[model samples]
Target: MTSWVKFTVSIPDTHQDALVAQLSTAGFGGFVQEDDYIDCYVEKKKWTSGVQTRSREVLQRFAKEYPKLELRTETTDVEDRNWNAEWERSAGIVDATKKIVIKPSWKSLRRRDKGKIVLHIDPKMSFGTGHHETTRVCLRLMEYYVRRGDHVADFGTGTGVLAIAAAKLGASRVIAVDTDSWSFENASENVLRNKAGDRITVHKGSIVALGKRPFDLVVANIDLPTITKFLGRLLTLTRKGGVLILSGLLMTDLVPVLRLINRRSIIPLLLADEGEWIGFALQRT
Candidate 1:
């Protein structure tokens, strides 16, 4: 019987991705974005005063940037049973792409979708359920690049969606890494549910968990701050001629991120933009 904390924030859609990423790092997990408001939920045991303060700081920073936007904030306590029902109602099936379909374990698939590639993801408190633009961007790019017998690594793999997809897409092996315990557990469960235990291994640590092994395809679908901090390490983890996919980027982050990328010897292959969110596919030199 785990209680939950719900934060209801009203802001423009333009800043949603940045908010979601910041909240994720701040300890908030479950997210639901509506037309005018985005609701963030976290287990009460994990949402400490520090997390609340950080969440407020995130909103204040956004307010400073867009003073005219009506960014209102509301906080409430949700009972465990209540949150479960809410999550189920909002967790509908997502037809992420022509070939990829993501659905929660509680839901059943349609007859028409029986032929498509399916991912049964129960995103308890983690991310990457293919409900976000960043997830979809990375998924499409992975479909295009993952070759047979290739090894893949999914950094900040929230619910192991991308890692599982990599295993199904012909990767010989997949490593999914997340530093947070919530994500690590959720991803581990998903990997087993997808029957990718033989091909995918979930690690609960930083990039160091990957050791010195280079991957054929590396994906870091994390926020701007994380990407900036580990860009060099991320590049080093990709072998020469291997591919790296970076997501959870807002359009505003492109210039600074590109400046970082330009410092390296990587070749950009694809840029998929969905609204203000985008994902980059680059090849190591």
Candidate 2:
């Protein structure tokens, strides 16, 4: 019998996206967003003491920053069963663009979707189902910039949706990297499922694994803080005039992130907002 540790955080609506992004980076998976709270689950085997500590720290910082919000946190342990079925029941086909449709293995597309490119993904606890606003915008930006024979790097490649899309859109080679072992495994499985194993390589680590190799385009659908931390490295890895797409940001994160990008002389190519999330596309100068 498998088990999971579920953590629920009660946060102000204004801070939901930022907190969710932080938790996701801390290796929490299978999130359920509510009106005023977010629930995240991690398999007991993967929920280490360090992860708990980091999650607490993030929540504590938020609490201190916004005392009026009265943030609350709780955790529980429960037996895991039939989560895949639950996920499938809740997730339907996502139309990322006119040309891109994301569907779980269990769902079938309608007759009208015959001409669209479909990405079959089974996240299985990893993120990026193409259902999130951030991922959808990232896919749209990827469609606009990715070209045939382009080499792409998908940083924080949860579930490899973006990397898979790059390959499907004609990238010659795609490197998908994530620090979480589960995400690496899940993304690998999805790559094979999408018949992209021959063109995509999944790595369980950060950008350093690439070792000075530059990519024609780089896509990072991660949080603002994490993206800021890796901004310089991401810029370095992108070829001059190459495209860089970033998502998983909130409206509040826009100013600070843009300041960091401007300091690096990166040119902003596009800015998109969906719901409360934001995505940016830039070109290496």
Find the candidate with the highest lDDT and give its number: 1
Q: Please, what are the lDDT tens digits per residue for candidate 1 over residues 66-143?
A: 688888889899877654566687788998888999989889899889789999898776888777888999999999
lDDT of 1 at 256: 91
* Cα lDDT listed for each candidate: 0.88, 0.87
| Candidate 1: segments with Cα more than 4 A from true spot | 1-3, 12-18
Per-structure clash totals for the candidates = 0, 0
Task: Write down the TM-score of every candidate.
Answer: 0.92, 0.90
**Residue 171 of candidate 1: its Cα lDDT?**
96
RMSD for each of the candidates: 2.0, 2.4
Reference-based lDDT, residue 180, model 1: 86
